[model samples]
Target: MIISVLAAAVAPGAALLAYFYLKDRYAPEPISMVIRMFLAGALVVFPVMVLQRAVVLAFGENPFLFSFVYSAGVEEFFKWFLLYFLIYKHVEFDEPYDGIVYAVAVSLGFATVENVIYSLLDYKSFSQLLFRAFLPVSGHALFGVVMGFYMGKAKFHTGRPLGLLAVSLAFPVFYHGLYDYILIELKRYWIWLIVPLMVFLWARSLWKVNHANSRSPLRAVYSEDEVKLPT
Candidate 1:
């Protein structure tokens, strides 16, 4: 029973990670590095939860503060810090799309562990598991996409590296804050708003993935002759 619940909890993150992993079609990151980042992300959950508990105790759970500051702000900032310091300069991070690959790896790693805890505690039903899979797990992956898109640009392109890196961190925090805000504050209308938010997130994430792939220095270049009429 526990094993089944754990498997269900882990499946979504693994599926999402695999999806993003395949997106790096041209040059996939080393399996070892991806696993390393994933484990690092999982390890941070302990400290993050501790800090969140301290913050909640201090602030007494103001909805706005809880969603934006305690949850999104703390979570994303740590992720950004980890991605920047740990993976950004590694030899394996050689292309634009590599950013998305690794960032999603870390984000899903965190999400998988969180899901397991939730499953063991509150969300035992099948419907609840489905809800958690599509929303919380998928949400983390989308946020990672936003963060990685900008990080990739900051890494490869010379224009405005600092600014782009700043955006990498800032944008995910804003999106995540808004996402949590809808769930925490909207009460009855959260369902309506959340669907549209997820739609927008999926669209934006797809664009980011494609755009990052396009910017890869390893991307294939076509010659005019290669495109000339076959006749």
Candidate 2:
């Protein structure tokens, strides 16, 4: 990838993610935390990518079904593990809104690496890379957004957290499976299904965070000194 084209493709999303990490300017993680989150995501993704490939091989010609399995079952599972083990109990993860930002950071980090692979391996031109970068890349981030939102809810609900977490995972899996089905099996135009579903998930997560938790990511982070991060 040409350096300039790569910058053009990555900059917008990076900036957007950073801005949100900063909490629409309300509160932002330390730049180092932001960078750490990004790296955590990228580093974690390598193994997940390998798992995706292995699962693909197992499914062979029916790549889409296993594609769904890999994406929902494997990739999201690790990201969730990252959030749970590292982010969940941390001081940084205190507020409900914190969930959305950290989740997005992790997801975007994965997306960033995934983007480079797709760009370098799949595309011949910078423009093609730039165009496709926005959608699938954002898709990954948004998928995390969905997962994070619900996670925040489950963390605090205490009343019925497991059910909430289950829904959170199930919803994303279904959404992810549908998205892959469109792109690989059914034909990509059906991807419109992905957009609306993503929108709904985002909206739902935000609603839960805003109404249920009512704290920003910044406050959440600072709040964690007492909370101890989950191991």
Candidate 3:
């Protein structure tokens, strides 16, 4: 039972990581660094949980405050801080698309740990695990894509770069906050609103992926490499 729960919890994040990692066609980041980022993300969950417990004790779980401030705000801030401070200027973060790959790695790492804990402590059925895989795990991946898109734009674009950097943090917090807000406040009615929000997130995340890929300085070089391949 433990092994099964572990597998169920880990699979969704691993699958999302593979999808984003494959999207970096031009210049793939080193596996070592990506794993390092994933570990870094996983390690932060302990500190975040402590902080969130403090918030809950202080605020007494007002739904809005708990959803936005305690959950989304705190989580995204840590992920953004890690990306901006540690990974932003690294040599492997050379292309715009690399941002998405690394950010998704970190986000999934956090999600995977959270999922495992939730599964072990509260899972009532396999169906519940499936539901979490569909919403919460994928939601984290989408949020990471949004965060990374702006970070890439900030790093590569010259005009109003600071604004883009601000969005890199602010946008994810807003998206994540609203996502949790609906689930927390609306309760059983959350499905009605969350579906539309999830659709928007998927649409927007795909557009960002394409935009970041197009902006890659190495795209032309990748094209050249493809051309040189023997038929």
**Top lDDT: which candidate number?**
3
Give a tens-digit lDDT track for model 1, residues 74-182: 9999888899999999999999998898889889888899999889998648899999999999999999999998899899877659999999999999999999999
Clash count list over all predictions: 0, 6, 0
Best candidate according to TM-score: 3
- Residue range 110-200, candidate 2, lDDT tens digits: 8887776676566677667656655677677768777878887777675968887776576667666766666676574665765676677
Name the TM-score of candidate 3.
0.96
- Better by TM-score, candidate 3 or 2: 3
List runs of model 1 lying over 4 Å from the truth: 221-231
TM-score of each: 0.94, 0.79, 0.96
- List pairs with backbone clashes in candidate 1: none
Clashing pairs in 3: none
* Model 3 misplaced stretches (Cα beyond 4 Å): 229-231
Rank order (by TM-score, best first): 3, 1, 2
- Residue 210 of candidate 1: its Cα lDDT? 90
